[model samples]
Target chain A: MRSLFHEELETLSDELVELSRLSARALERATRALLGADLELAEQVISEDEQIDALRRDLDNRAIDAIARQQPVATDLRQLVTTLRMSADLERCGDLARHVAKLARLRYPVCAVSGELTDVFAQMSEHAQAMCLRSGEIVSAQDASGAAELQQQDDTMDRLHREVFRILLEPEWDGGTQAAIDATLLSRYYERFADHAVSVAIRVVYLVTGVWMDEQEAASRDHLGGGGVPRAGI
Target chain B: MRSLFHEELETLSDELVELSRLSARALERATRALLGADLELAEQVISEDEQIDALRRDLDNRAIDAIARQQPVATDLRQLVTTLRMSADLERCGDLARHVAKLARLRYPVCAVSGELTDVFAQMSEHAQAMCLRSGEIVSAQDASGAAELQQQDDTMDRLHREVFRILLEPEWDGGTQAAIDATLLSRYYERFADHAVSVAIRVVYLVTGVWMDEQEAASRDHLGGGGVPRAGI
Candidate 1:
């Protein structure tokens, strides 16, 4: 019974990790669609949103069922609940991807963001993608170091997001105000996606380490003058 | 031991319902601040957001702990999992409330949504608030019929949301285009709030009736006419 229960827990983890992989690809495709102005890919992302939604629902149900029927104790139960929460975050990430695809449709044939701004967005997308990939990796392997790396990647995305907003607010940009505003909102969506990825990573860290690394990191940073801290930051 | 387990489960449910109530109030107060241009209330809502976040994180840990320690049976496991998901949906709903409060801050002293459009937004807010309230009621009472009522309220919010979009897209309204666009996104945020409320209500319906109402409703609608169906009419 004990081994069977462990096997079931492993199976649940495997399914959740699969959903994370699907979610990562969805975001990547959405970013590609936005950058390349590919309506076909955008439409595909929009349609596939239902699949992501279905997977999220399925995973939640499975996690709940596993917890109930198997009567999983302690760490096993934590794993199931974490899977449930992560599934919702992944679904929202997919929703963000669909929102990006909607923008693609709105600004089809011509990219909404152009030139230097486009480079910023592309970098932002790459950062978010990396965070998503790292998050999934950490969850799959239960690697605290990988999860920590994912959190750092989110900081880079946040910095880039601030830069994107600063450019949008500046009055010097003479052309494409509406498009820039749209891109501004798009950047926020991508930034939030990265935040959610980091959120998953934080959970992974907590799952393995049994401590809220972000909170502890923040506390440590505060104690160290907020900037002099090495390798420890929220 | 069994009674202790039941007591913990009951406390979890009660705490979640209380959190839902607190969230609903925050959303309502934030909307009121917007419609009335009450900055003080908006500030209060902003401050209260921290409490909601704290409650969310607390409930999250408790839910995970419950699953970990209790080894709940199938239905109970589903309940715990649903509670976990509902907490997330609730947190996002709180974020939307904060978004509304921020809009109130940005466009203060004067109601940004003006003239007939103001009336349209007011109606939308009314419907959205009603959904939020009904969702809380249903959650507290575990009333399936009340959950269905909340679903109908969401349908009303969706209709008002579409009407707001229509006004924004009209060619004649160009003077306050920036404000109009902001209002457009604001209405969307509220509409999405209603959507999340409906999601929560649907989960309540599932918990009470052991039937997934949304899927069944969609199936019936698809068979009936293959066109847009009113969610309220379901």
Candidate 2:
């Protein structure tokens, strides 16, 4: 019975990795759709998000069933609960990706991103996709070592997010109101995508080390200029 | 043993209601901070968010303990899991409120919402607070009846969100870029706060009726415009 529960746990972990991959792909396609003004691709990302949502529901049901049937305790219980949260983070990532796609669809052939801001967004998209892929690796390997790296990547995204704002705020800027709104929302989608990836990685770190990563710890380490230890908190 | 488990569930429900109240207060104070440019109130909201986070953690731990100790199945298990999800939604609502307060802090002494937009934001804030309060009632009573009312309030929020965008996108709009960014983020924070409240209410609906409220169903009903029945989905 114990071995069977472990097998179920393994299956659950595998499903989580799959969800991460799906999220990464969604973000990638959504970014491509935004940059290239590919309505079909944007539509695909929006529709495929339903699949991600379904998979999350499936994983959640399995986790809940395992808890009810097997009654996992201690570290095992933590793993199960963390899986539920990770799935949620990943699902939200998918939604963010879909939001990006909807923007692409909304703009259609015109392209939501202005010419000056395109490169920054391209870089942001790449960083977000990389973080999602890395998050999947961390989940599959159960290795928290890569968690810090994900935070750094998210920092890059944040920096780019600020840059986008800087461009929008330029006094002589002429990106029009529609372009400004589109750019603002687009930047946020990428930034939040990276944030969710870091969140997933943080949960993996907690699952492996049993040390809860509080917001202040993550904020201090990632946003407050680094090298700070993860503060101990429940 | 069963009676003891039920008693624990009641305690869990009470904690969730308390969380909703905390979230409502956070939004209230955060909005006041934004409109009045009240630095002290903003700081209070920011610091007090830690308490909300801690309460959520405590509630989550208790739910996990209940699951492991009682090994609840079927409806009982669903209730416990739903409670966990609702706590997360409420916690996120607090975070959105915190984000609003941080904006107030970032623009300290200078209010985020410009003169023309202040009334819209004020109304949005009030709607959000009311939704949070209603969500608390739904959780405490396990009453699904208020769920529709909560969604209607969210619709009001959604319309206001679009109105904010419309004003920003106007051709003659002269709110400086800083004000625009501040308004954009502020609007989103309030909209998301309402979204989370609706999420909590939907969970309460599911907890009572066992009829899952999928995103598409809610979207079709809310976005697709009135009288649409909730479509069945897993």
Candidate 3:
């Protein structure tokens, strides 16, 4: 029974990695669609998000089942619960990618990102994709070190996001109201995509270390009797 | 033992209502800060968010404890799990409110929203607060009809969000890129706040009716062997 439970846990971990890869590819295609004004790629990304949603639903159901049947205690329980939260974060990432695709489709033929802002968006997209890929690796390998590196990548995305905003705020910006709105929303989509990736990575760190990313949070949890219900010894 | 479990469930429901009230007030104050350029009010909203976070943590811990100790099955189990999800949505609502407060602070003495956009934002804020308060009532009473009404309110919010975008994209818009960015993010914060409130209300509907908001999802779940693992009719 113990071995079977371990096998189920491994399967859950593998599914998360798969979901992460899907999210990364979706973001890649969505970015390409936005930059190149590729309506076909945008449509594909939008349609494929349903698959990501289905995968998330399946993973959630499986996690709940594992808890119900195995009655996993302590660390095992935390792992399952954390998996549910990570899947939610990844699913939201997919939704953000779809939003990008919708924007690309909306502007079709005329790139929503115009002028010098294109390069900034291109860089942001690359950073976001890299962060998603790294998150997948951390999930499959449980590599706490890789999770730390993802945070630095997220910082780069943040800087790029601010750069997009700064350009929009410049007096020389003559992209007009439509362009300003497009740039503002697009930058946010990429920034939030990176944020969700960072959130998943942080959860990974917590799962492995049993320590939250926020030091104050960790201390508070200790005061709350170890953050969750005390499980009976298996 | 059954009576004790019921008592715990009632306590969890009450906590959810309290969390909902906190979210509503946060949105109200954050909006006031944005429109009035009240830095003190904005600071208050931002600082008080930690208390909301703490309350959500406490509720989540209690729900988990109920699950582990009582081992609730079927509807009882679904209710507990759904409570956890609802708490998360409420916590995110608090975060969105904080984001609005931060925007207000970023602009300081100068209002982030200006000109005709102020009225739109003011209306959106009212809608968001109304939705949160209604969600609280629905959660406490399990008012399925009230839950349905909240969906219509969310629809109004969605319409307002689109209107904000329309005004931003107007050829005559001279709010400057900074104002445009501020309007875009602020509108989204309010829209997302409404969205989370609607989500919590829908969860209540499901908990009471076992019917998903999406009929197609319900059909799909039915095909997945009664939606979750088959409990042994405990």
lDDT of 3 by residue, A85-184 (tens): 8898888888888878877877777787878998998898888888888888898889877766887776687677767776776778887777776777
Measured with C-alpha atoms, the lDDT of residue B201 in candidate 3 is: 85
Enumerate the chain B TM-scores of all models. Answer: 0.84, 0.91, 0.90
Off by over 4 Å in 1: A1-4, A106-117, A146-148, A163-181, A215-234, B1-13, B35-39, B57-70, B103-121, B163-181, B215-234
DockQ result, candidate 1: 0.18
Write one digit per residue (lDDT tens) for candidate 2, span A139-191: 99988888988887876876787778777777667866667667776776787
Q: Model 1: how far is A85 from its true place, Å?
A: 1.0
Best-to-worst order by TM-score is 2, 3, 1
Which structure among the candidates has the greatest TM-score?
2
User: Of the pair 2 and 3, which is ahead by lDDT?
Assistant: 2
**lDDT of model 2 at position B109:** 77
- At residue B48, candidate 1 shows an lDDT of 84
Q: Residue by residue across A10-91, what tens digits does model 1's lDDT show? A: 7766766776777778888888898889989988987887887888777777766766677776677677777877777777
Docking class of 3: incorrect
True contacts kept of each: 0.21, 0.27, 0.25
Which runs in model 3 stand beyond 4 Å of their true positions? A215-234, B215-234
Candidate 3 C-alpha error for residue A130, in Å: 1.3
DockQ, Cα level, model 2: 0.31
lDDT of 3 at B218: 22
**Model 2 lDDT tens row, B1-234:** 999999999999999999999999999999899899899999999899889989999999999999878888899999998899999989888988888887777677777677679989999999999999899889999888898888888778877877787677666678766676667767777877888888888988888888876657563332212221111110
